[model samples]
Target: MRYSSITDRLADLGSEKWALHIRARQMQASGTDVIQLTIGEPDMPTDPLLIAEAQRAMNAGRYRYSNGRGEPSVVNALTARYTRRRADVTAENVLCFPGTQTALFAVMLGLVEAGDGVLVGDPLYATYDGVIQSTGAHRVTVPLKPEHGFHMQAADLEKAITPKCRVLLLNTPHNPTGAVLTADEIKAIGDICRKHDLWIVCDEVYEELIFNGPFASPFDDPELAERTVVVSSISKSHAAPGFRSGWAVGPVEFASRLLPVSETMLFGVQPFIADMTAYALTHDIGTSAAMRTSYKTRADLIVEGLSNVPGIVPLPPEAGMFTLIDVAGTGLTGEAFAWMLLEQEHVAVMPGSSFGVEAASFVRVSLTVPDTVIQEACARITKLAIRLLTPKERRA
Candidate 1:
């Protein structure tokens, strides 16, 4: 049997991060003390209230397929949350999915056609490149510079826009880099997208994980609300990745168009999970606040520790669960550094090249690990850097 061209394409998009994670797990199983900083999932436990809500729903035998759009309860809860954040959003604008990745794939397939250009930030979430490629769309890269806090500038967007560019995929409190867009930057980028008549997919899965300052959404600008589709999930915020629940909020017409695509792909999210996610969103679980505080402390510790290490420049992450450390000073490519670290110190991290070429000199370290574990990992990294940076003859 032969597979379709799309299936063949999917093979090339295999995630380097997950591959490293798997290798680390295998090593750990074999008695290796591997400190994992590869995957982005929160190490925090899921909120007990959310767990109770789901268990209660299941116990009531509410396991039937939900409405294709979403359970009314979940949609209403999302609408209310968005309404508080942006007054323009209503129930009609919300569509639920099993996960943000699926929501992103559905939106790309629904809106983009073959050969259409999708402008995305370089060093973005690695999975996005695969999503764009699988949709038969071209990915137009706009490099995010460390000097700019790794945020995309409007000028760069304008320069990257071509006649074929039909969409702009934006990730705030971005993956790998932890660069959160400011209100002014969001509005400016929105203006650029509006000028080019590009559809905007704003991945705000890390919306609740902000540290340095307040978060600004593209939807904050009323004019962009109609053009922007906000993709978010309970995975990062509520520490509920196992639930696989997320949502897309946009214009009613857009939601209507995306509904069939979502239905065809997932049929509908599990009813019990939807009910629990609704409860999680509506009720105060105190989980997000706690995760935020914990991650901030972790990020600060890692940053300070790495700063003191020779040949490593750790960028202080403003938000999200990871930080990109420039390892060029060690005279090693990101991939080589990651491999060496794993082999020498048993610390598994993602190579920056996995994100994009622009980050080839860096490696991303996850902040999801415990403080003690992070400290140990930093110590190992410091030792490795010192060893690598020292003159061979002098060390001998």
Candidate 2:
């Protein structure tokens, strides 16, 4: 049977991170001791308090379909949190989804039409490309340069925008690069969007994982509140990817338009999960703080270890759990280096080409492993680098 063109559009949706993850799992199943750093999932287990709260909710028989927008408590908690950050947010402006991925996709589909241009920075999360493609929209890229600390500038945005462009997708504390935008940078970008009359889909899922000072959001500016849809989740912050709960905050009209799309996508988040998530949002849970501290330590270890290695250059991460390493000096493409590292050293990492053509000379390493594992991975990488670079006649 022939499928719709949408199926063809999704042909490239499989991400290299997940591909490496599956390969690593297959190797491990075959008894190989692989140190997998390809995926960004936290190595730590879910917080016990969250687990207990979930259990309590289930025991109380809270299983039922909730309002498609969200349960009142979850909505209220999110509303209060965002309102505290920026005075324009309220419960009516929030919409919950199964995950931030879905929230982002829904927002894109709701706002952008076929042939419309969605401007995104290059070296972006792999899924963004697929999401934009699935909507039959154009994925226009603004090149992010390393000299500028990988932050997107308003000047670049102005240059990238065109008559067809309708949306600007921004990710702070960015995945793969770990580049966080400053408040001033966000304001500049927002100003550009305002001039172009473009909507901003701010992916702040890694907001809580920042190593720097306080997290900054475009919504912090009330003027941009009408044009911005903020997508976030506890997947990274609380280490609860399996729960698949996330939310989007925007102007009331924008959120109301997104709700119907969300409803058609997945009625609502599971009620029991919603209850636990609401509790998590409202309370001062210490899990996120603890995880942040641990991730910072791990980031330091890996950065320092890779710095001593000869061929690879590890960029120091400002926030988020992954670091991008320039692998061009090794005389290998990111894909070739990733495969060689996995096969020869039993260490897995994501090829930078998975993100964008601009990142083809790089590879992303996740700091999800423990300190010892990170140390060992670095050692293996260094040894492999030496072997690959050594002259054959010198070996004897």
Candidate 3:
């Protein structure tokens, strides 16, 4: 039997991260008590109000098919939800999906083709390459510098765009590095993409989790908003990932642009999920706000621990649940460093290479675990750092 190429592309999705880490998971499953921090999932409880809303929807028999777009009120709630950050948005501009990851994949299928060029940031979200590759597009990575706090540089992004570049994938409060793009940085990207006539796929799933300041969107401007496709969800925000709810918003021409392929992705998202999602979007969504506070505290604790460890060069993670600190100074390769920590310390963290090509010297540690777990993990990591460091290396 012959298998299609699309199936091959889809199969490689996130395999890199999991391929090497499966042994650790197996060890964990065998009663090793591994504190897994490899993924971005929050460890908090789902918003009770949102859960109750889902129950109400299920009770009301919202179990059938949706209008093939999404429930109207859900769409409207998403429209109004973004009002504070970007005032120009309305219900007409929104699209709903089971999650942001799928919505993002739709953008690729809709606007990109086998030979098209799609620019992604370096040290990117690992899934970006897999998803874009699934679209049969060329993935052009624009590397971000460490000294600059992984902030997207204007010139690098501008230089990366070519005539065939039709998509610009942007993520603020980025993963692995936890770097957020400033307004100027976002504007620089938006301006260039618009000038080049490219579709900007902005993943704002972490928009509501900013620790230091307000989140900015490319949709802040009318021109960019017109060309921009916004993907967001409750996974990171409301801690309701099990609900499997998220949405997309853009020009309907762009939003509905991939409905054909999306229908193939999964027959429209569940209606009860959509209804509860609508309630959460319209409701207070206070859980997201409260989680942000806890996240900020954890970030501080992690940074503090890493800072005191000899030969560990750490930076503050102002957003997201993780930090990318250079572990090269300890004389261990990224792969060896991560294995040593997991095997010796029994604390599971991601190797920097899981994120991007130039990440071999760094390791990403997630802060989603409880305070005690984080503190204990920090102790083991610090011991590993000290053990790995030579007297000569520690001097640096």
Q: What is the C-alpha lDDT profile of model 1 across 206-226, one tens digit per residue?
A: 998898689998877788877
Q: What is the TM-score of each predicted model, taking all chains together?
A: 0.97, 0.97, 0.94
Report the CA-based lDDT of candidate 3 relative to the real structure: 0.80
Cα deviation of 359, candidate 3, in Å: 2.3
lDDT of each: 0.89, 0.87, 0.80
Clashes of each: 0, 0, 0
Name the 10 consecutive residues with the lowest summed lDDT in model 3.
12-21
Top lDDT: which candidate number? 1
What digit string (tens of lDDT, one per residue) describes model 3 on residues 1-396? 999898887776756676546867888889998878777778888877778878888899988877566787687778787776678777667777888888887778888888899998888887887779888887888888897888888788889888888888888878878888888888887888877888888898888788887677786777787788888888888888777788778876776556666677776778888878788777776876777788788878887888878767766776887877788888876777888889988878888887787677888877788988888888888988877766777677
Model 1 residue pairs with clashes: none
Least well predicted 10-residue stretch by lDDT in candidate 2:
387-396
Name the lDDT of candidate 1: 0.89
Reference-based TM-score, model 2: 0.97
